[model samples]
Target chain A: MTTTLALLVDLAAIVLLIAGISMFRAPQRARLGNLVAALALTVAVVLVLRRHNVTGLPLVLTGVAAGTILGWIVAVRVTMIQIPAMIAFQHGAGGVAAFLIAFVELTRSAGALTPVTRFSGILGLAIGAATFSASMVASGKLAAKLRSAPVSLRFHNGWLWLCAAFIVGAGIALLLEPASGAPAYAAGIIIVAAAAGILFSIRVGGADMPVLISFLNATAGLAAAFCGVTLENRLLIAFGAVVAASGSVLTLVMCRAMNRDLLKVFAGFTPAAAPAGAAPEHHEPKSPGVPPEDPFLAAVDALKEAESVIIVPGYGMALAKAQFKVVELAGLLERQGKQVRFAIHPVAGRMPGHMHVLLAEADLDYEQIFDMADINGDFASTDAVLVVGACDVVNPAAMTVEGCPISGMPILLAHEAKRVIVCNLDSRPGYSGVENPLYESEKAVLLWGDASDSVSQLVTRVGGEA
Target chain B: MLDLAIMLAVLVCSFIIGYLLISRVPPLLHTPLMSMTNAVSAVTVIGALLLFAVETTGLEKALGVFALITATFNLVGGFTITDRMLRLFRSDEHHQ
Candidate 1:
C-alpha cells in the first residue's frame, strides 16, 4: 500500500509537470498553467517529504514559510518594468539553493560518494555558484544599480579559461583524494566559479541582457539536474531538465531575433566598427547645423493629417513610464478615425515582450499590437510612424551599415512611412553605440522630452483639435 | 551505475521535449514563460528535504535548511510573479 501511494504521487507529479509545460506554450492558458504548476509542485513536495519521513518537519515548514513570504512580497510588489530584474533574483536564489544542497551532500559523505556522484556534485556546485553570482550581476544591471555598459578586465577571456582549468583540476583532485580536505577544495571551487560568473556577465552590455539572463537560467537548471543526480531524485531531474531545455531555447530565439552569433555572445565580442559601405563620417551627425524641427508642433501636425500610424516602443519607453500616455495618444488617434497599431520588435524592451506587457497594462486592444514580421509590410503605406523612445530597433543603419554590430539584423521600416516622428530625450546613440540614421532622415523630426511628458503633450494637443 | 544511466536518459529526453514545447510559445508570452520555468526549477527543494530526512551532521542540517529556504523562495516567487504578469494579458472577455 505504501509503495502504491508513492507510485501514485510520482505519477501525479509527472502529470502536473507535463500540464505546466503544455500550458506555458500557449499564452491563453499561461495563467491557469501557473496556478496548476504551483499546486502540483506543492503537492509533490509534500508527498516527497512524507515518503522520506523527514524528522524536522517544523524546521522545514519554518523555512518554507519564510521563503514563501519573501517570494510573495517580491512577486506582488514588483512593477511590470522590474520583472526582468525580479526574474534574475529568482534565478539567483535557485542557484544558491542548488549549490547549498550539493555542498551539504558532498560534505556529508565525500569518501562514500561514488566517482559519478562526486563528478556530478562538482558540476552542480560550479554551475550553481556561477549562476548565483552572474544572476546577481544581471539583477543589479537590470535594476540600474550598476552601469549597463560592459565592464571587462584586461585579458578577461584568458582569465575565464584559467578559471575553468583551475576548477577542473581541483574537481579531479577532490575525486581522487576525497578525504584530503574536501571541504576546502569545494569552497575553492565555489569561489572560482563565482568569479567566473562575474567575469562572464560583467563583460556583456545591457543590450544583450535578455539572452544572458536566459542562458544563466539554463545553467542554473543544469546545476539543479546535477543535484538531482547526486541525490537520485527523479522529480528534480525532470524539472531541471525541462527548465534547462526551455531556457536554452529561449536564449537561442532571442539571439536569432537579433541576428547575433551565440558563440560571439559567449566570447563577449562586441562589434566596434561601422559597416564598410555606410558613410563612417555621417554616422554620428548628418547635418550638425540643422536643428531638429519643432518636435511638438511637428508631431501634432503629423497626427492631424495621418490616416494611419504605427507606434514603435523600446526600452526608453519603459524607462520613462510612458506606456499609458502612449496608449492615450493611440486611442485619441483611433477616435479620429485613424488606424493606430503597435509594431513590436522581438527585443524591443529590456526583456522579451516588455512592450506588450506595458501596452497590455493600459488595456489596449490585443488586435492593435503586431510583431515585427506581422506588421513590417504595413509601414510603407502608413501615413505616419511614431517612434517612441525606440532607437536601434528602427535605425536604418542596420540596412546600410556594414560590419556594424547590428547590421543585417531586422528592424522596423519606420523610414518607409510618409513621415517619421521620433520621441526621445536626446540624439545620443542607443545601447549599441551606433548612431541611428533614421533620426536624420528628411521626413523625420525629433521630439525632445521624457517620453511620457511628450506623449501627454501630444495627447492634449490632439484632443483639443478633435 | 544503472540508476545514473536512467537519470541521464530522463534528463536528456525531458530536455528535448521541453525545448520543442517552449519553442512554440509566442514572443508575446516570453516573460511569463521565463518566470514559469523559474518556478519549475525550484524542484531542488525536494532534494534538500530528502537530505534533512536522513541522518546528518549539524552542518549538513543547517545547509539543508538554507537550501530549503532558497528553493522555496524561487518556487513561490516565480509562480506568483508569472501569474501576476499573465493577469495583465487576459482579454476583456475574461475581465468582466
Candidate 2:
C-alpha cells in the first residue's frame, strides 16, 4: 500500500509537470498552468518527505518557511526594470542549491559511490559552482553595480580553455578513484569552474548579455539534472533536462537575433569596432540638420498631423522608468485616430525581451507591438517615427558604415519615415560607441531630456492641442 | 547499469519534448517562460528531502538543510514573480 501511494504521487507530479510546460505555450492559459505546476510541486514535496520518513520535520518546515518569505519579498519588491537582474539572482540561488546537494552527496559517500554517481556528482559540482558565481557577476553588471563593458584578462580565452581542460581532467581522476582524495578533487573542480564562469561572463559585453544569461541558465539546469543522477531521482532529472533543452533553444534564438556565432561567444570573441582612423566622422554629429526644436511642441505637432506613428523604445527608457509614459503617449495617439504601434528590436533593452516586459507592465495591447522584421517595412509608409530613448537600433550606421561594431546588425529603418523624432538625454553614442547617422538626417529632430519627462511633456502638449 | 540506461533514455526524451514545447511559446512571453522554468528547476527539493530522510552525519544534515532552504526559496519566489508578470500581460478587457 505504501509503495502504491508513492507511485501514485510520482505519477501525479509527472502529469502536472507535462501539463504545466504545455500550458506555457498558450499565453492565455499560462497563469493557470503556473499555478497548477507550483501546487503540484508542493504536493510532490510533501509526499516525498512522508514516504521517506524524514526526521526533523520542524527544522525542514522552518527552512522552507524562511526561504519562501525571503523569495516572496524579492519577487514583490522587484520592478519591471530589474527583472533581468532578478532572473540572474534566481539562477544563482538555484545554482547554490544544486552545489550544496552535490557536495553533501560526494562527501557522505566517501569514495564508495558508483562510477555513474561519481561522474554526475563531479559534473554537478563544477556546473553548480560556476553558475552560482557567474550569475552573481551577470546580475551585478545588469543592475549597474559593476562595469557594463567587457572586462577581460590579458589572455582571456587562454585562461578559459585552461580552466575547462583542468575541470575535465579532475572529473576523470575522480572517476578512476572515487574513494581516494575525493573531496580534494571536488573542491578543486568547484574553484576552477567558478573561475571559468567569471572569466566567461566578464568578457561578454552588454550587447551579448541576453545570450550569456540564457546560456548560464541552461548550465545551471544541467547541474541540477546531474545532481538528480547522483541522488537517483527521476523527477529532478526530467525537469532539469527540460530546463537545459529549453535554455539551449533560447540561447540559439538570442544568438540568431544578434547575428553572432555561438561558438565565438563561448570563446570570448565579440566583434570589435575597426580602427577609428578609417571613420573618424562616425563619432560626431556632423550635421545638426534642422536645429534641435522644442521637443514637446515638435512632438505634439508631429502627432497632430500623423496618420500612423511608430514608437521605438530602448534601454534608456528602461533606465528612466518611462514605459508607462510611452504607453500613455501611444494611447493618446490611438484616441486621436492615429494608428500607433511599437517597434521592438530583439536586443533593445539590457536583457532579452526586456522591452516587452516593460511595455506589458504598462498595460498596452500586445497586438500593437511588432518585432523588427514585422514592423521594419511599415516605417517608410508611416507618417511619423518617435524614437524614444533608443539610438543604436535606429542608427543607420549599421548599414552605411563599414567595419563598424554594429555593422550588419539588423536595425529599424526609422530614417525612411516621413518625419523622425528622437527623444534622448543627449547626443551621446549608443552601447556600441558609434554615433547614429540618423540623428543628423534632415528628416530627424533631436528631443533632448530625460525620457520620462520628455514623454510626459509631449503627452500633455499633444492632449492640449487635440 | 540498466537503471542508468533507462534514466538516460528518460532524460533524452523529456529534453526533446521540453525543447519543442518551449519553442512554441511566443517571444512576448519569454520573460515569464524563463521565470516559470526557474521555478520548475527547483525539483532538487526531492534530493534535499531524501538526504534529510536517510541517516547521515551532522555535516551532511546541515548541507541538506541548506539545500532545502535554497530550493524552496527558488520555487516560491520564482512562481510568485512569474504570476505577477503574467498578470501584467493579460489584456485589460480580460481583467474586467
Candidate number achieving the greatest lDDT relative to the actual structure: 1
Quote the lDDT for A412 in model 2. Answer: 91
Model 1 chain B weakest lDDT span, ten residues long: B87-96
List where candidate 1 sits over 4 angstroms from the true fold.
A1-11, A269-293, B93-96
Q: Relative to the true structure, how large is the alpha-carbon lDDT of every model?
A: 0.84, 0.82
Q: Candidate 2, residues A241-270: lDDT per residue as tens digits?
A: 888887887888888776667876665544
- Compared with the real two-chain complex, what DockQ does model 2 have? 0.70
Q: Residue A329 of model 2: what lDDT?
A: 92
Give TM-scores for every candidate, taking all chains together and pairing residue i with residue i: 0.94, 0.93
Best-matching candidate per TM-score: 1
Worst 10 residues of 1 chain A by lDDT: A281-290
Candidate 2 deviant stretches above 4 angstroms: A1-12, A269-287, A292-296, A400-403, B92-96
How many Å off is the CA of A43 in candidate 2? 3.9
Candidate 2, B1-96: lDDT as tens digits: 766885687678778988888888767778888888888778778778877876778777788888888888889889999999988885655555
